[model samples]
Target: MEHKIQPLLNYISKYIVLSKKDEAVLMSKLIYRKYLKGQYIAQQGDVCKYECFVISGCTKMFFADEEGQEHIVMFSIEDWWTADMGSFITQTPADYNVQCIENTELVLFSYDVIEELYTEIPQLERFFRKIIEKAFVASQKRIVRSFSLSAKDRYLYFRNQYPKIEQRIPQYMIASYLGITKEFLSKIKGQLIIDQ
Candidate 1:
């Protein structure tokens, strides 16, 4: 069980050093979970119960508008964290849904547990703060890019960030993430092939 926690500890260590005692405090609070593909980890209008750190596989965080179309907010894979930040922080209803894109293994800490961990391990709080800061920065950049760049450019940026992800997921999911139609995505890929 402790061995299973090493990857998460190593990830946290990249942000802030964790004493073995601090690690134990954190490890005690963690609950490991596995989700099959197509399962919902968090749903809109419900409080996000846990802060999730991905150990393996992929998940999609998205918003489903009134028309019932899903606009992907982001993707999380190995070594990534996925949660509705506002919901997790405030214990309020989530605006986005987090769903498994592949069979996923995650290390989870509930909202109450996070508060407990913070008091027990100050470095844990600092590590989370850093993660939140990066997530916010990335969100802002994605918003700016959506306004400034064409769909093709956005797809290119995503490809650069997750080169092998395309082969793993459906083209339509990637298209939805880029705010484009699947047919339009096909056309864009065709154009890229010709350009190359």
Candidate 2:
């Protein structure tokens, strides 16, 4: 478990240095879990109690519309942090669901544990603030791209950003994430191959 948590510690250390005591406290608070593919780590309408750091494998955060069409919001891979931010922060029901794309290992921290960490380790607060800022920036970029870019451009950008993801997950999920139909994504992929 300690070995699996090194990636998370390294990630935090990139933003803020942790003293030995802070590190121990943070480690103590984490709960490790393994999830199989197709399992949900969080479900819509449930209060999201924990924020998870991926130790391995992949997951997708998505929401189903009234018509029951799933819209992928984001994908998380190894070393990535994932949670429904509003739900976790406000202790409200999540609007999105997080499900594994492959068998996954994660280290989770409850909302209360996070708050305690913030108080116990000031540097951790700074680290999390930076993490949220980055998430916000990424969200803004995705929004801008959706409005400004064509489907092909969006797919291309996504491919560049997460080069390994396409091989791991089904194409339809990628299409959903890009807000395009699977047929359109297939056409785009075909065009790319033809061009090559």
Query: Which candidate wins on lDDT?
Result: 2
Give the RMSD in angstroms, all C-alphas superposed, for model 2.
0.9
lDDT of 1 by residue, 68-177 (tens): 99999889988999999899899999999999999999999899898888888877788889999999999999999999999999999999988867778888899999
Off by over 4 Å in 1: none
lDDT of each: 0.91, 0.92
lDDT of 1 at 28: 77
| lDDT value, candidate 2, whole model | 0.92
| Candidate 1's TM-score | 0.97
lDDT, candidate 2, at 92: 99
- Tell how far residue 97 is off in model 1, in angstroms: 0.6
Q: What is the TM-score (0 to 1) of candidate 2? A: 0.97
